[model samples]
Target: MAESRPNTEVDLNSWLPITASRKAKWWYSAFHCVTAMVGAGVLGLPLVLARLGWIPGIVAIAVAWLVTWYTVWLLIQLHESESGKRFDRFTELGQHAFGEYLGFWMVMPQQLIVQVGSDIVYMVTGGKSLQKSLALITPQADFRKTYYILMFAAIQLVLSQSPNFNSLKIVSLLAAVMSISYSFIATGASLWKGFGEHHVVHYGFRSTSTVKIVFDIFSSLGVLAFAFAGHSVALEIQATIPSSLGNPSKKPMAKGVTVAYLIVALCYFPVAISGFWAFGNLVEDDVLLSLEHPNWLISAANFMVFIHVIGSYQVFGMPIFDKIESTLVTKWHCTPGRPLRLVARSAYVVFTAFMAILLPFFGGLLGFFGGLAFASTSYIMPCAVWLKTQKPKPWSFHWILCWISMLIGITIMTLAPIGGAHEIIVSWKSYKLFQ
Candidate 1:
């Protein structure tokens, strides 16, 4: 019976989205991590810097990069923590640490929010980038953003039919390339504008009001936190790599993460520093938007951003697709087939697209969702699980590190939403939906 149990479980997971196959290589991890990490979030770093100023902004990005890297390493280690028992999903790892029921409740909600919220943000990103590109190409061609969002949703409705994570290799790779391409373009444009003969940049903070500055700082933490959100899907990504006693997934995963972080550092610092240097406190919420000149380059950069977010949408959406489909089959006894995927995934794309069209406050959405859920999954949950399961000695280095990371995560989770909500309300005062 014990041997039979293992076969049965393997058969079940064989049809699931995340665990359907395990043929991915180390380079798969590299680009997938890149596709996951460097999405719409990086474009907003300049705005975060605008709120934070030079010294604090640089420190904040550096600290966030280090913190998430450490916590993600912890998550990768926990994936196979139990000998011969792999926790393929974040929820499974949570179950190991906190027990089944508490783990499900603790991790599921936060994971869902991170996944679904990311899709929504990606929808907004794709649409806005598409809009920007089109507007630049044809200055007189005016169309409502609502139309562009639906067009983006239409593409997702088709691509969301991809069977599993392994099937998205090409898309993810292109996205990784696109991310690097646009980051360089934005950086180059910013550097040019900064050194242009008419440069008139101010290095002051975005606001002078102390109260507002505090809230903006809190909100900026969420923005910075959002950039490190690849941790939320770390376990799922590693689950794609084949594992055995002789060759563990962690070795390759760590290698890939190192490569991904180097790419992230290269993409992040140049854009943030260059954009802020170019526009100073006057930088737009998205650095790309601030680069108005060199119309052809900015337009191509926006198009690349559009393509990248398309892949990012799938990288984030695949897990949610797995959850929804697996739930219907396991609990409701619905038959799994093309019909199930077609309906469930199309419905999801439409839902996120609608929500994005309704709000479409890019920076505000990042801050709100970043604080509300991204902080928990990316920063807090991994460290908390490490402490719970590893049982490191009290006041030891690992113990103290987890505690400190959890505290910072808690701070971001509590305060960022208030700041984000304030920004949303301020935008709402004169804003019209679907405009």
Candidate 2:
């Protein structure tokens, strides 16, 4: 007779299951995703729209939302399908899904690049907003953008030292609401200028391209891809959702993601369309730059952009800080949330701000990070992990879909960065070091 064994109930679902004390409400999850995805993208949309024109740019936005949201769902699927092990961070998920080497080499580096790049963008953006705002009062002040970046860096260093993820929810929520506020303000400005002032609403239909049309299309698509980069923290946010000993359907996470993405798309397309209508071929890197002066709306929107980026920087920086704190505590015998950790994180923010001052090639870096990191972290790896974890049959519908998505990601990674690099090169000629 077979040996009798004790009965044990096992969980085949719910990776990163939330304990009762640690559980969060659904709105926090929604706000966190919104804060992660919306920054820097809105400011850069007019140029992206101009590059791809109205038709393709709008299509790219829609397609990117579909692809990004689908990959996020794949991650959710993978998390739900797992039984024993759990993933609470991006690198952890990558290490589990792929080999350890790929996680350390490819996934970790790309994510770090993306995160650091985000910090740089915030510095550049906040500096520009400060410069433009200060010009209103001190029109003769000759300080360079670097001073403004340093100024903003001081603010970010303070914000970055928030104790933990829970501490950032209100800031993240404010950042999300700030994005909505300024998106409407900027969109309204565009509409008012296009219809109210100019009385000429122009639309682009792929009429202008400095490079080859194909290159422009993919490059613009990269910008759209970058706009939806909340996937980096999807697992982190999901972990905050309230799960129980028995309840493990992932419904809260799913609902939160759906609401968050819907909110993103609603803010994204209207601004893109209205900005394109207002500026035509004259759209600047930031749509706000295209808005004429003597307008308080332009000033208000720019100030809002600066204020929002201040909070949003903390959202992106928290995950990086968590990683660093964990390493210091686990390996280096440093205390968490103590002086050493605070100094290290403050230095990290200053380093990113310094790099932005030195390079200030904001638009190009946006494209590059979009093509390189966003494609992989946001789509390819998630789909790959979903396939590996689920182990669907070869050539099955799910398998075919995953392959197509992976191919698309690879294509974006390969082609779009070239455009980004060329853009940086072109912009470099006009730039000087430290002012």
Candidate 3:
């Protein structure tokens, strides 16, 4: 039988397959959200701090946290509304609040871009982390690009091929643990490198843009936004929370979200502040890359971070896989759990791997897409959706808050891309293609 098309206004609880197993509890829910929020993006927070100074960098991280937290709440609020019909997918919510045509156009493609783009980030980040770890024994294996290519193959071979997104609960939890472990390691190592070893110039509470880029402030700001964002998968992950324990009552999800981002702030701030203090204007795009030689602790930390990104890659990619698999099954009448689906997904992984190796300016491209693409889907759309779906009275406080969020989203959406684009251009000029 053909899979029934998703109905946004229908009782998603009755139909969505996610509710069947109830794979996630509150802590697991927090794990997935934290892993999603703090993946490859966190690698760049130190660099953001380097540009914005300690005070400003800390402020930016806080503001991003509050905004993202609220936006997530908005998404959750809108997801549960429409008189008890809940939505599990962002595209579904888009379809529900806005016209179906505009809604699909707004949500789906942005997700696809983010999904594919994030895989690229993982390949690069994971590859770099793997390379750093391996470099401990054999210091001469210095080609960064080679490691990225190797890690792509490694992930396909080692990581479990999940049957569906829900099955990735274990992966998400492990990924979260790995992330926390490494954050502490990285933070401690950075502070030590800065204070103990004296390997870098210190700039306490000062900001500087090391790279000459258009909209330099916005560019650095984009990196911070990317670091805190996980909204794309928020609803999908939330759907797995048992309905009885979720919104309209218990709001275990709300508790989970709060705890998750608190973990993020705790983990992120130390790394950002410590890293900038360590490297100052000399900080590289990835703080791990800035680690000086013969540091066993940092090397082990890198390995742990490397292992973590493997799971993070799957967490971000599975939703994309689900969407694509649905389309293939729906449009082409392809059966699920079959060779064709596997082949299609395998092909996508390869494509993303190549793209990551091709454009290795880790900070630039991701910042651009993160700010432009994710900023809206995560930030802009939630506010816009609430304003439209809730039908609030004109000029009310709620109305103003929604408008303010939209404005902030619009500014970020517009400026961050310019900064990201500039980063790409400058990086392209600096690095020889295929060198």
The number of the candidate with the highest lDDT is: 1
lDDT of 2 by residue, 1-435 (tens): 222221221211121122112366777878888888877887778778887777777787777788888888887655544463446667777777677887667568877777777778788988888777666656786688899888889898888766667677788888888888888987888887877754654454343454555666556656766787887777766766655536653677778788999998888988888888888756777787777554566677777788888877887787677667556555675543347556878888978888889878767777777887878878788887878667889999879878888887888888778777777887889888888
Cand. 1 Cα-lDDT: 0.90
- Candidate 3 residue pairs in clash (backbone atoms < 3 Å): 53-206
lDDT of each: 0.90, 0.74, 0.74
lDDT of 1 by residue, 1-435 (tens): 111212245665887789998999999999999999897889999988899989989998998998898999899888896575788899999998899999999999999998898899899899999999988889887899889999999999999999889999999999999999999999999999999998887888788899988888888988888898897788999999999977889999999999999999999999999999999998988889888788989999999999999999999999899899778777777677778788999999999999999999888888988999999998899999998888999999989988888998999999998888888888888789789
Residue 159 local lDDT, model 3: 51
Q: RMSD of each candidate?
A: 3.0, 6.8, 3.6
**How many clashing residue pairs, candidate 2?**
0
Model 3 earns a TM-score of 0.89
**Least accurate 10 contiguous residues by lDDT in model 1:** 1-10
Report lDDT (Cα) of residue 66, candidate 3.
Answer: 80
